[model samples]
Target: MKDETKYSQVWNLDKLYPDGSASTQFLDHISHIESKVFSLEEGLNFFNTPKEINHSSKVADLIDNIGCIRINLSQANSYITCLLAQNPQDQNAPTLKGKTSSISARFDAGLKKLQKILVKTDHHLWEDMLDTADLNPYKFILNEWRKKADMHLTDDEESLVSDLMVDGYHAWGQFYHSLIGSIKVNIQVDGERNELSVPQAINLRSHPNEEVRKESYYALEEIWEEKKEQFAKILNHIAGFRLQVYKKRKLENILEEPLMENRINEETLSAMWKVVSKNKQPFIKYLNRKANMYGHTKMKSYNFWAPIKNTNQKIKYEEAVNFILEHFSQFGTELENFSRQVFNNEWIEAEDRPNKSMAAFCASFPISGESRIFMTYGNRITNVLTLAHELGHAFHNHAMKSINGINRQYPMCIAETASTFSEMIILDASMEKAESGEEKLFLLDEKLKRSVMNFMNIHSRFLFEERFYEERKAGIVSSSRLNEIMHEAINEGYVGSFDNPSIHSWAWTPHYYITKSPFYNFPYTFGYIFSLCIYAKAKEKGKEFEKDYLALLRDSGSMSTEDLVMKHLGEDITSEAFWEKGIELCVRDVEEFITLTS
Candidate 1:
């Protein structure tokens, strides 16, 4: 029966596009946007004052049209990408990839022209037009633009910068992506031979066999070590490019660019991590005991995910769905019904297959007013957690469904809030229902493993990015220098207690220097702990808090992370108090695992 099920069985593309003509509609819509932008530009010339300008109405209409165009374009691109990922060797996939990129470039040029005109407009005039704009939806976006006045360059200069950005910054990311995806790992498991992709190889760390775990770790390191120099070159080039941009803007701190883009204050981030660092004693102790349980005197990177005991657990997909929906019902009717809708409506694509998109994510389409989940569910306990996590994202989008078009795009810092919160609920429920000591210990260890990876592993990478940019700005940081900096960051975070002979080899993972999202690591920890705080509230307040939680998700796109925390939880984000509280909640699970193991 398990073998009979396939990954393709879970995908429902009909919700995204009912027919093939949708691509034509999408092209026509974007073409019309290009035509209207010319008219909008001409109208701007007729107005002497921004207050007298009727640019608001036109801008609002344009924004809506653009949003629709994006959603449709994304749907088309995603469909093709998913198909291609399922079978890259498909002859039609190559043409689709080229066409997708060409379409994207054309759309990018149009946006650049519009941005050029907007940047040329007088600030006060633009403000007045924004205030007078009939569409309240665009007010937030326009205000954000004005806030970034310092970042604006001359129209031609900005266009040139944008053009350079694609080949320079973006291409670096593309290169790294291709490099990582092409790499394969071969590990010897007992008498058998095993081969896995990068993600799958990483997942093997959770396997119970100590030898298998060690073999997988060395296999990963071997592949990465072979590519280390070229990988370092890629990292250096990307960081160098970013530093040049920062230098051009005269930004004093390298972190300033991503902080601005994240719509967060540095004080808030520092405060959060400071509390996280201070609370590390509990996690350190937790790891020590967890290591002892696994019969290791000191934990190695290989044993980081080693199970605390035998679980022998399996969750069938249907049974997993029932468990998710049952726990969600405790939140309220909205979540309960939303889960049902997601499962019933072809919103999810959950099946494991060879050569599919390697991970899971939820994408919301504004025009279609729907969400699509993409994953290869293997009927593992972890797979169920993935579904619950993605559904949380979908629930977040559902909360924003009635909001204006421009406000739907949330900042990355808080993007994982809903998803992690969902994971907490599902995991907590499973722990509560565990029938044996070992089962409880296994669940508890899994949760702590997540916390450790987020704080120590991912956070260390973020620190490396910061230092890399700082050094790169002064001059190009050599490949050796990059690895040295990475080693220091890793030692500062993870190397303290672990007596592992081999280091984590942080240079091998490309996320540290990926240009797609610089400083990409800390947010996971933030979201992880932040969701814990929310989950705590949900547990205490019961169904009553669900409304507030939904409201929080709806406002996430429009507000700063600090404001979101303040508004939803009434916690001061620039202080250690809230973070301390969050860390205490994390330690509770650690404490429980200790008890379960004893």
Candidate 2:
């Protein structure tokens, strides 16, 4: 069976290059870039005048050098990542991780010098130069960073903060990652006891045996409860430090900073959630139906993802690839051809095995014009959906490849649209071919689960973050206060459907109080709702919208969230009506699923 599966395959990096010598060559190129970029720093004041900037075309030349350096460093890191995916405990893994960070720190330091020059120099000068060259790769790159030029501290202070943050805020994030990844749990599988990590235990919840699912849930609850206090301390310290830093920067609101960085506004966020909160009943109805199907009167948190009766169907690797290829072909030629290239070129890793990375990601290489997808794919229907999801991301990168490299940078909000849109494509198509009542019910349930996360769960996170900042402005928010905010947020968001109060608070989620990305939670909701709207438009407009869709993807690097939506959808992001429409779409799905299930 393994031999018959295309996704039972692993990547061969030797096809990229033979060995350490290749990495050494790449490192040497970065070294050369490090020396050359310093000259740009020295010549910064000359960039004040367009006439004087003719000396090696200042920003353009700097961008080209930086692009080359990025490609080289990225390729080296990717080569190591591919190797590490196969054997996570590989000795080279830690070394490669450290080396990547060190190399990134050095690159960041040099880039900070360029940023200082931007802050001190006449901003109009660079923007004028960038505007002239539609082809000059730095167009989007400079525009994005230029927006933040006003927020930067003095040159010395900015540099010092950049250095301190590497060790201070960023290191704490790494610490959380290490702690969560290493924690072990005891879950009963088939009446046998075994220790597993959180990721592994969560995976067991999808197992066929009901007992296994129940055991996995209790095991996670036990482990998280035991470590709850320590996790609380980490959250407190991180959030406390972040608020202190924000205050020093003269930022009055925590939401203000994250909103600014997200290229969005508070009005838009509130509008989106208002719609989600109003339509919450449909989601609650769907949950109750799902719970009844599993023979529970009211749903327990543990049973949220339990399979519907007789709905377990295996979707083989080859079948999943073909399904994606066929549905994507409906989109257009360029997309279809790209999917084929990914499959034929062995660009996907989908084998399920022990000691592999816990999850999946599709990383695109701007220079190589290639994307590699990493996931341990099993022979399940959801696995196929996951494949389609990641490929959506890959297809997005493929679309952006022709854009100037600098403008290819996309915001996280727009980033998930294409991926979720692809999942919709697959799920929608899969429903048409579903053979039985059970299959239809299962598919509908999965769709509803997505709606829950996108609308209800993510909205709760935003609510929590909003209140956390409101309170934090007064003084340092204690761990207990943090938990209270979290509980209040979840209660308001969920509205008592989830009855278990014991499991509802501060469940060791690191996002609740991360220092670097203070409001990391809301972006998921933003990305989901925003992308769903775009996807709905695509379905309505059909082939007529392809050119505009491609244009949107291409310009994603250059435009703000508000500007992009206005240009593409004719809807103002700040308008509550626009978000209500997106929320309505999710409510419609829940209604449709109920009709089908009942």
Candidate 3:
């Protein structure tokens, strides 16, 4: 085994702040933002008059101030979040979290006044504001707010809801986060007693040993069972709070906000799922093959990420970096250069250590034009792919650095496009480099694993959330009901793939607990297929497609998902034909896996 320490590097936060999280400068910046928010609130009182609203210079100045405050607040929040991710046990992290949350609340409270003014302003004046040089960059953002302005409550009511959320709605999410981060599982593996965090135990699902995987699965199930009720309450409360807010805003569809947030319509979402449902049979075939590889009559929930076979070659961290860079260079010089900068600057924390957060995410700091990636890397090819995945996010961010802040915030649907595209590049390169049949089979399995996940596993999550939300509208869903819903969704998507379904699946997913983004599950499937289609285009066009791909990434934040895809790919997302193309690509991979393994 490679020394895990050699592969790990503590990311540098100096770019965000010359001093770390506790730096005096950071605190002073927060105080400055607090004072500015108050001043902006006071200034909004003058902008209510028609004549004052038409003063382009004055309105432009106010917009600039708001933009500055938002950028600074984002920078500080990113710093604290980075610190917290690196050391979840940090005593000061929670305190800073509270402080930042309050600052955000205050800022939102102040922004509501400006929004109210815009809502009441004459349409002609609004047009003038959009055309103003200072405010033109934010035209898209302002127009979106204008579209929803009528649905908004009075400023006082909105402010009340925002403040209450700090303690009420959002607190539930925090509670869930704390519970997962602190929970420990005790399981006996190979005649030795072992204690693991929730994340560490979950990682064992991919372990090579069957007994360890089974033990870890049961241990996780037991722990989740014990907390099922609490998890249920958290989900209900979060959904309940959202429903209440939506009702007050006069919104009917629970999906309306998420759709708007993702910049896609119901037609597009429906089309994507229709194509996915039709393509599920191939994945089922792959699952059956996977079960045979494991010497089982049928697969189980624990077998989802299980390694088909283990290779003796272990990829070191430096070797992984080189491998990623080499493949990326084949695509474009820009991609390779960006990956090198990430390694040289130590922008990743991939060490295997205790108490670190579970799962990997790439966080981009637009203010500093940089990104930070968090993941625990062991010497595995999966780790190499993960590194490429995150670097894809950084590369996307790098492309968007030139855009204004408001335009740079892409929705989650398109957010995974670049990352998934990067994974495709890495997978193809690995398959080409594999020397033996066993190695080729292993690599093919890895590629097929993602197809299974995006097509079947994530489809299950989407079905579960859709049904849960529909049920939640009537009344509070009991724990048993949640389990039933989850089981039905899993069985529907994974039909005949699992001998026994995971009923407690709903209890452990952190996505259900996110208060800011509701119905966050389907975006993974959307991004995956979307990226696959883009990757196929790149393959057909050779190096010529690189420029177009980068252009798509740069424009991702500025337009709606439909518009972005249509502009770059000339494909309408609302059409079933467009989605079918992506689904067929996934099916092709499954067929290839079967051929290689057989």
What's the TM-score of every candidate structure? 0.90, 0.90, 0.93
Q: Which model, 1 or 3, shows the larger TM-score?
A: 3
lDDT: which candidate is best?
Answer: 3
Candidate 3 has its poorest 10 consecutive residues by lDDT at 1-10
What is candidate 2's lDDT per residue for 454-531, written digit by digit as tens? 766776777876886677567666656666887777778877676553332454555664655677777777877787
> Candidate 3 regions off by >4 Å?
1-8, 49-54, 128-135, 352-355
Estimate candidate 3's alpha-carbon lDDT, on a 0 to 1 scale. Answer: 0.83
Task: State the lDDT of candidate 3 residue by residue for 1-598, as single tens digits.
Answer: 4365443466777766766666777788778878878778778867663454347677667777787777777777878888888877778767877887787877776676677667777888778767877677777777776677777898688878977787999899999989887899997766888888788788888888888889899989888889999999999999888989988998988889989999999999999988888878888888888898888878877887887778876778888888898888878888888888898887998877777876688887766778998888877888888888988988998998787665777899988998999988998898899888788778888888887787777888888988998888899999999999999999887765787777898888888889889888889889999998998898898777889998998888777899889999999999999999888887877888888787
Name the weakest run of 10 consecutive residues (lDDT summed) in model 1: 43-52
Regions of model 2 farther than 4 Å from truth: 3-8, 20-56, 122-131, 134-143, 208-211, 473-476, 501-507, 513-516
> Which has the greatest TM-score?
3
The CA lDDT of each predicted structure is: 0.73, 0.71, 0.83
